[model samples]
Target: MAGNGGHLTPGLVNTRTHLFQAGLRGIGEGLGLLAWLSAVGEEAARLTPERAYATAAAAAAEALRSGTTTLVEHMWPHPSSEVHDAVLRALKDSDVRAVLCRGVADRADPSRRWGFDPRLMQPLEAALAHTDELIAQARGSRVDVGVAVPNPRCLTPKGMGAVRAYAEGRATLARHGVGVSYNPLSNMRLGSGIAPVPEMLEAGLSVGLGVDRAASNDTQDILEALRIGAYLQRAVHRKADLFGFPEMFAMAAGGANRMLGIEENPDGGVRAGTRADLVLHRFDRDHACLPVRDPGATLLTCGSSRTVAAVLVGGEVLVRDGEHVRLPSREPAAGLARRGSCGG
Candidate 1:
């Protein structure tokens, strides 16, 4: 790989996303968070199982093309088991490692004033039972299951306690510690407040980069996320040296693995004994990325899907020369267009 003047590094781990929103991209462009949720919820209510499968597959492929090996999908509340199954199947078929967080909202609020949309809510017991079924189905696959609440307002007191107990019983959060997914693009797009990354780092927290859902960020490009994440902190603090390339790269790659309980190469880097989830990039391929004095800086600033020559997950070559091995480049986009939806 070095013979061709290419750089090899660990693939990025997207800590949060909503893959189903691939079809809903560009729907609520200028709306605030609450208004945007209402707008997205209307379209989300119309999502069918086939649409879910197509959108999820398309979104996962987009993430992979941008050098994301693992994605954490935080689905919103929906009563359809078929829709959830379709999303899982799509991720499995795309061959990307994923944690499918089944969304649950116990509180019902018809008006967008206080709580989650009642149309998307299901009984807590039923949601838990369905999640168990999903776990059983995903046992031997590359996908995992977890619980997701849109926000604190979405959960009742009893629901919170039940979710807390369930999470504690299933995973060792206390042992591994907590992590934060710093989604700068999503926050900026939604007009949400900036995350105090420097302070978080000073306090010794593991922070990772996330493109979030395509609906909010409109892209799954981790390179862009890394660049924006660093620039945002620098702009807010008026300090150009706030976050160097190495720290930003770590956050993009494997900084949140401990929080996610990902045992494969917990501390992400190119090393022996780590899972071969890696990406190969050629700076010479892009004129803007040439003369790479610092590979990390070049990647964070000038890199895009065009610079990614190949991507490997678990030593398996899934993308070669910026194209997926098993999926046609146009299939995902065509699938969305067929359903009368546009890509973000």
Candidate 2:
């Protein structure tokens, strides 16, 4: 059989990434969440205004190449709606499947913030409406538009609720609900407190896992993200296993499908008949290293992006032997930030 070499496989659920900032991975030592954001490179600022598409596309290529099939981007500070659509198209340019979860960021008091873009409430409101309309329009089509509420530290409690309400409303459109994705790390890094994830779930919201961007996380590990979410829930509810491995697995795999609001027969375990988003990686060699017998434990603790060998998105092989097969973009966005764009 095929050993070191691999075959097309299921991909990961990368529900929260800045896409444009995909190049931003390693630059400084992260003491904690807050300290990491303080060290982010300056290239993020330049990605806005006119160069958003290139950035987003670069992120898609990075994820697609890394065996990530279902990518949900949360691109905030976008120049305009045209830029948002352009970025979405860029994600599709690759063989990997993508969900454009458009993110919006602004402050209640525009004057207090630093060099901050004025909280264009009307535009944001219009954009939210536009996302809903687009998702509906894209029914039964490839490349759908999902909604995302960007970093909440920029807003108050009312703002967080607004995000939740909008996401919940959007989820109900499909048979199962909406495909919801987010990054609490970005929010936490920006001094945003723990998201009311338990509250969001209580309110009938469908949420999923995401790794924000390399710039924010310093390192992108979905397993660590799952632990972060589970830890937060335990701290909040005082229950250790309220959100256990099974729930975490569901969140990682089916969360996007839930956000898509697609219905199923409930017997599939990453099987066929679902919108194709799968990743195949080399784990057998690594499995014997620790001398553990259970594969699930090995995957949860020992696994990282390095294990991924190939990825299939929408039945398309984006990553073969850990390489992206097709990407329409020329190259990663150009810049000076060592993290965001492959410039410096």
Q: What is each predicted model's overall lDDT from 0 to 1?
A: 0.85, 0.57
lDDT of 1: 0.85
Candidate 2 per-residue lDDT, tens place, 1-344, comes to 23344333345576777765555555444445434443442444344433555556666666665555666666665435665666766766664556667665545333323222343333556767667765665556456676655455555566556666776565453344443465656555555567777677677777777877867664455646655666676777899767775666566665555545443212214665666776665665355425545545555556555666666766666666555666523455352233434333
Candidate 1 local lDDT, 1-344, one digit each (tens): 24277888899999999998888778789998988988888878878898899899989999998899998999988988898999999998899988888998898886656678998888998998898898888999888888888888888899999888777778533335568899999999999899998888789888888999988999888888989999999999999987777888888888787777675444456787877888999888789998889998898889988898899999998888888887767988787886443212
Look at candidate 1 and give me any clashing residue pairs.
Answer: none
Backbone clash pairs in model 1 (N, Cα, C under 3 Å; residues 3+ apart or in different chains), count: 0
- Give lDDT: candidate 1, residue 327: 74
Q: What alpha-carbon RMSD in Å does predicted model 2 have with respect to the real structure? A: 5.9
Q: RMSD of each candidate?
A: 2.2, 5.9
The 10-residue segment of model 2 with minimum total lDDT is 335-344
